[model samples]
Target: MLSFESAGRGILCNDAETRPSIWCKGVQPALPLWLASHPDCTPYDPASADEARAILRSALQALYVDHQAGFYYLATHDDTCVDTGPLHRADAQGAIKGMYRLRFTPEVSTVSTASTNGNRKTPPQIRLCGAGKALQRVLHAARLLSQDWGIAAEVWSCPSYTRLAREGRAAARWNMLHPQSRPRRPHIARCLGDSTAPVIAVTGYAQHIAEQIAPFAPGRFVALGATPQRGTAYADFPGAPWITLIALKALVDEGALSAQTLEAALRTYALT
Candidate 1:
C-alpha cells in the first residue's frame, strides 16, 4: 500500500535567494487520473479526518487480511480542518468493501417523503454529492435548499470518483459482452437506482472531475467545480451560494420551480 498526502496548499521552495512561495492550487483534478493510469492502482480520498482514519484502517485490512496484491493509493489533503469525531464509525468495517460507494452525510434525513412548497405538491428532491473540502459546501447548500426553497436535498460524501467511474466502465463492458446474462450494475447505479431526482455533484477540482460520473448518474446530473464559466471570474472553488443557484436552475428546468424563482435566486446570489 502506497500512501501520499498533499496539503493542497501548493507551496514550493524556489531557491536560497528567495522565500518559499505558495502556488495556491490543488492537484485533486489531475491526481485521480494520474493514479488511475497506473496498473492495479486504487485511489481513495476522504472528506474528513474520521473518514481518513477509517480509510487507513481499511487499507491495513486490505493489505493484511485480504492479502490484496494491488497498489493502494490513499491520497489526503492537509488544507482543511475536519472534525475528528467518530462520524464514520458505523461504516468503518465496510469501508474497504465499499471504497467506491457514496455515503450519505449525517444531515440527510432517513424519511422518504419530499417536503412540499406551500400548498403545492412536493417537488422532486435533488441529491448533492461532493468530496474533500467541497463536501462542506455541499452540506451547507443542502440546508439552504430546504430552508429557502423548500427543496428536499440529500447530501452524499463521495470518496473516490475515479473508482466509481472505473467500475462503471467495467460494468458497461461486461454487460455488452454478456448480452443474455443479468446486467451488472455499477456502484453509482446501485447507489442511486431508486431516485430519479437530479444529482448535482460538486468538487474542488476542475469540473471534469465530477463530470466523470455523469454518464452513469441516474436522471438529470449537473457537475460543478472550480473552473470559471465564460464571462464569470475565475474561482478556486464553488461555494454554497453557487451550488444553491445551480440547484434552483435545475428545478426550474424540471418545471418544479417557476422561471421567476430561478431568476430571483440568480439575483440573490448576484450570479446574473
Candidate 2:
C-alpha cells in the first residue's frame, strides 16, 4: 500500500545536514555489520531483529508480488540507522530487492590535500552495486581508505545491477531527440558542474554490471570486481579495505580522478 512517492524517499527521512554522509537502502542489518569493521564506530546497536524482519517483509513482498522496485534510505547515528525513505522505486514487474546507505564515521576526515581557489567543494561519491553481503568488503574498504587517502568518499549501496542497467537504458531512450540525433543530454548523466569528484563503482560481481550502467552518469567511472584471475569467487572479506585503496590509486594514476585531489587527500593525512 505504499505510494510511489512515499516509497522513493521512505518515512522519517533525515535532512542533508542531519543525515549520515553514507547510508544503505535495502537491509537494516548492514549498518551494524559495517560498523563492526571500523572499531572507531563500534558499540553500535543496529535495528532490532523485529524491525529488520518488518523491513524485509515490506521490501520482499513488494518485489515478489507487487513488483515494487526502489532503494529505501536509512537514517543513521552513532547508535543506529533508522529507516527513513525509499531511494528509487518503480511500481511494476521486475522489482529487485536490497538497497542501503552507509555513513562515513564522523571522526574520519575525508578531505582533499589541495586548496580550492575560491571554488565550492564537493566530496567524491562511489556507487556500490550487488547484494548487501557482496558490497560489505568494498564498503569497509571505502570507509577506512578514504580517511588515509584524504578523500571523503560517499558510498551508495546498490542492490540491483539489473535494475540500474534497465534504468540507464530507459534513460538513454528518453534522452533521444530523434532516431539519428546524438544525445544532447542523457537523463542520468551526472553534471560535472555539480560535482567534480569521480564516481568509483565497486561490486563483487561481473565487471559488466558497472559497464552496463556507465552511460547514465557523467563523472569518471571506475569499476572493481572479479576478474579472470579471481574467477567468480567473491572477494575475501579481509582484503576488501586494501582492494578499495588499490582501485582508488588506479583511478588517480589513470588520470580518471584528479591527481590534485588524491595528493590533497594524502597530504591531509601526511601519507606523503
Candidate 3:
C-alpha cells in the first residue's frame, strides 16, 4: 500500500521540497517543505512590501528558537492583498502597487497561506493587470511560504475571484482538479482529467532532479524543478495509510484552515 511516484511540479509558495507521510496522503501542514531561516534573501517574483518585511523579519529572527519553541511560521503572498473580514485598509500591495511598505500588524504570529482554488475555498486572485478591479493575485510569494524564514513580516494572502489565480498548489483535490471551466478553469493542474485521487503515470519521474515529494514530510523532499521528458504525464499521489488511525494524522494548518476552517473540518468529518 506504499505506492510511491516521485516527480514534482505545481506547489510553490516558495517550494523547499518536503515529502513523506507515506507520501502526502492529505497534504496541508501549512504547506511545508521548510522555511525558517533568514537574514534577508527575497524571492517572490515582482515583489514588494518593504521587500517582504525585511525578508520576513530576518525569517522570524532565525526562528527565534522555533518561535518560542511553539512552532508556527507561515507566510504566503500568493499575491499580496489584504482583507481579514473587511479590507484592513485595503492595502493593495501598498495602496495599489507602490511596491512595499506592507502592513498587517496584530504583532504577527503565523498560520498558513495560499492554497485554495481547485474550485474555490478562497485565495484566488490575480487581477490588477489592466485594473478594473475584480481581484486576482496569487502569483507566488510569502517568500513562497517563507522559504527559509527570517521574519519581521505580516502577510497572509488568498486573492482571486475573477480570472482565477490561486497561483499554484500545495494541495488540491475535487474530482482531481475539478474544472468545468469557470473563467477558464483555475489551473490546479488545469483541473486534472477525471479523478477520484489515486491516479498515477508521472511520465517517467525526475524532471532532472526535483522529486522530493512531501505527502507527510517524514524525510521531506521535492526539487521537482524540471519537466518535459516526453508524454504520459499524470500525477495525483496521496494514499498510503494502511491504518494507524489513518496514520497518526498530521500536517493541517494552512493558517488555521480558513474556508471557514476547512468547512468546519468537513462538517465534522461528515458526522464521523
Candidate 4:
C-alpha cells in the first residue's frame, strides 16, 4: 500500500515526530535510488516544478519495485519559477546518488593550487558544496570568489544530506567492526579524499542539516545554512555574499589569506 501526500511546510511541521518514516527536504529534482535500502515511508518536499516531476516518477518506480506497505508523502512548494536554467540534470542525478563532487574547475587542476609558474603563483583553492536553490548561490559564490579574491572554488551539489550521513555512519560502523581490514570509506570521503582544502557545505535547511557531513569531511569543514536569528521565529538562508565570506574565512583559518584580507572582503560586501 503506497500512498503520497505533498505540502511545502510538511518537513517543518513534522520533522520532530517520532515515526517510522524517511524525510527528504528541499528541491530534489531527481531519483533517490537509495530508498530501496530502507522500508520506511518517505515524505519528500520539492520546491521546483522539475523537482515535482522527477520525484513523482522516481517515487512511482520505487513503489513498483518494493511492495512495502507504507505511505509516501510528496511535499511541494507553491513558488514556481521559469528560470530553471540553474538546475543541472547531471548534478541532480549525481547528488541523489550521493556523489559529492558535482562540478570542478578543470583549469585549476588541483584543490590546493599554490604551485608557482615561474614567478607567478596560482590561486588558493576550496570546495563549496550546496544543494537545491542553495547550489545556485554556491555557483555564484564560486564566481565571486574567483573574480573578487582570485580564489579557485569548486562547486558540489548535494541533494540528500540525510543519505550522505546515513552512508557515512554505516561506513564508520563497518570500519569499527573490522579493525584489521582496510577501512571502508563513505561516498563523501571517497569524493573529497584527494583534497586537503577546506570544505564548505551549505543548505537551504538549517545549518545542522549541512553539519551532518562534518564527521566524515576530510579536512576543515564549514557548514552553513538557514539559521534562525537570536529573537526571530524565522530562519535566514545564507546567500552568495555570506557564502563568499565564509569561504574567505576558511582560507584565513588555513593561513592562506591574511586577517586583513578577510576584513577587506567584509567591507567590500558591506558585511561590516
Q: Write the per-residue lDDT of candidate 2 for residues 120-167, one digit (tens) a residue.
A: 354444443333334456556666555554445555555444445554
| lDDT by residue (tens digit), candidate 4, 149-257 | 7788887666556667778888999999999999988778877876789999986666766787889877799998775556634455787998999999999999988
- Where model 3 places Cα greater than 4 Å from the true spot, the runs are 1-51, 58-62, 65-67, 70-272
Q: Please give, for residues 1-272, the per-residue lDDT of candidate 3 as tens digits.
A: 01112122111233222222234342232322222121121122213343344334433554453442222222233444333233233344322211222233322123323333333223211111111010112112222223211112223231111111122222334334655533332232333223222111110112221122123122212222113224433232221111101111111222322344334433433523
All candidates: TM-score = 0.76, 0.47, 0.17, 0.71
CA lDDT, candidate 4, residue 148: 78
Candidate number that wins on lDDT, 3 or 4: 4
Clash list (residue pairs), candidate 4? 5-74, 6-74, 7-75
| Each model's backbone clash number | 0, 26, 51, 3
Kindly provide the TM-score of model 4 when superposed on the true structure, using C-alpha atoms. Answer: 0.71
- Report every candidate's CA lDDT: 0.65, 0.42, 0.24, 0.64
Among the numbered candidates, top lDDT falls to 1
Cand. 2 Cα-lDDT: 0.42
Lowest lDDT 10-residue stretch of candidate 4: 8-17
